[model samples]
Target: MKKTAQIFAGIRTPFYYYDMEILENTARQVKELAEKYRIDVHYATKANEDARIVSLLSEVGFGVDCVSGDEVKLALGCGVPVSKIMFAGVGKSDEEIFEAGIAGIGAINVESVQELYIVNAIAAKYGFVANVCVRVNPNIDAHTFRYVTSGLNTNKFGVSESEFPELVEMLAQCNNVKFRGLHFHIASQIKDIAKVTKTLCGVANRAVEWFAGHGFETEIINLGGGLGVNYENPYGDTFPDFEGWFKAIDENIVRKPGMTIHVEPGRALVAQCGDLITKVLFVKETEVKSFVVVDAGMNNLVRPAFYGAFHLIENLSAEERPSLPSNRVYDVVGPVCESSDTFGKGRQLPLTVRGDLMVVHSAGAYGQAMSMRYTLRPIAQVVYSDRINEAEKETPIL
Candidate 1:
């Protein structure tokens, strides 16, 4: 294992620091494991939009899965092969579909039959035959955050079972469209093996029956990424047990001849190696509650504000304590004006003061990608372990 300090223990706070060495290890593990079963894996770019990160992933022999036009462009611009890109999203506009179709992408994962019509029309306008997948709402509860729960029957993400008859009729009308397969994405942060297995079995059974009636075999079965990580111990558990994750599903599901299995992983692959480093601006203590106000806020990382998500907050400056660092609990807040801007409430940590350094673990995947410029707190630099020495001169935190 690579030493954390040697790579990048601290050079800046209020900015995202990524351990490239850890990511390198993670990519190797994921690729080697998935290759064992001949599974085609696509790294979802929605989790982290950094072009350099995408480039590294491209170098590691992986495909790209995008949700928007810009994300598709980012993946391609960063060197992902056009033949290996798949587009996904529910609200894709005419322009977004137009752009992806024109890019000569591998396929577009169409969420609704309405989307199939739009994408096919766009491809027709471009004089091209586009490959696409119909996203099926299997209605399997992913047991994740409500906001991220998409496969539920009422969610607005995919085509419902009730719409199957129309979908089959529409597939017959696709003269300029190729219905390549079916896709399903349940939710995020799911770690239970049985839950995923049940979902896989359910999709396989449904699709097999759907195909028998319609004479359209599922060429690809895509189970979108919702794999969870150990945010509290990012370094120790950066890699997921793909053998269990993939094997469980593989054993449970029956694939058609020459069927391709695609997985679009974002957080599970990239979350652990990232940290949001910030400097304590003020340590305010009140009779009612204590707060650790920092330069970072919802603007820098919104997981806390958006989902009431939990991330491990640590005092890097207090590393040398004889025992564990200060165990006192306080609200780790930012400089935002909104009451929802706080990162965490009653967050216990080392006793801290102004200028002390704080490291918020697992800020990599959704952290920087979701940052905003609210209140104009200057955007922090993204430090990668591979180039930390270069960023140090330019992004040295006080």
Candidate 2:
């Protein structure tokens, strides 16, 4: 911890610090475990679209799972093979669909029958056959936050099972569209292994039989990744139980011969490899409580304000000065004008002061990707730990 603080003392505050080594290790483990089951893992581009991160994953041979046209272009720009890209989104624009069709990417997960028609039209215009996967809403409760849950019937994602007949008829009518497989994503941040596996098995089994009965042979079944990471204790569970999760899926999902399983993992792969570093500006004590104001705001890392998310906070300076009494509680907050800019309330830490550095763990995934310019706060710069060692100059906190 002391060495970590020393490393950050030279770095600018309110910047994203990524440990590339950890990222590579996590990817390697996930890749190994996924290969053990012969499953294809696609790194969801929405998580952390940092060029270095994207380039590294592409070089490592992980498929890119894109949610938008820009993300598709980012993967392509990062040199990810078109055959290793899978595009999925609810409200894809006509232009986006046309772009995907023209790129001749691996597969596009069609959300609705209308989207199927649109994609087919674009593909026919280009004189190409567009391979598509049907994103089905299994309607299973992912038992996660409502904001992150995506598989419910009420959610604006995936085509429901009730629309299967219509979807089949629409596919049959579209000559330029080829049905490749089915995609099911219950939600994000799913922790209950049994719950997700059970729901997925039931859905995959029915989907296989449904396709078979319709005289369509399914080649791939994409079980969209929702495996949660340890936010409360990122270090303790930096790398999620990928082996266990894969084993559970293997034991549960009955697969047909030559069928391939694909997973789109976003948060699980990158969440633990990064931290949000900020500097304390003031420690204000009021009649009700004490607030440790930091330079980073909700615009920098909004999980706390957006989803009431909890991240492990560490006082780096306090750790260095071990002589200070450690029994102090403060509300770690940001300088955003919004009242909800608080990161954590009643956070107990060693006695801290202004100029001290604070580290917010488990911010690698959505932290920088969701940043905003609200309040005109500067967007945090991202620095890789591996590169910091090469540059010896101190970076002033902006």
* Best model per lDDT: 2
TM-score of candidate 1 on Cα atoms, chains taken together: 0.93
Candidate 1 C-alpha lDDT tens digits along 1-398: 33233334445556688888878888888898888866788998889988877888889998988998999889878989998899989999899888888877888989888888888888888898888888888888777789988888889888888888888788788777887788888888887855675665677567767866797777888888888888767657877677778787777777768888888889988898788888789999999999999988898999989999889888766664537547888998999899998878888787787867788888888988988889887777887766767664325555
Quantify how close model 1 is to the true structure by its C-alpha RMSD in Å.
Answer: 2.4
Query: In candidate 1, residue 296 scores what lDDT?
Result: 89
Q: For every model in order, what is the number of clashing pairs? A: 5, 0
User: Which candidate leads in TM-score?
Assistant: 2
Q: Write the per-residue lDDT of candidate 2 for residues 135-197, one digit (tens) a residue.
A: 999899988999999999999999998999999989889999888899988888999966687
Give the runs in model 2 whose Cα sits over 4 Å from its true position: 1-3, 389-398
lDDT of each candidate versus the true structure:
0.81, 0.88
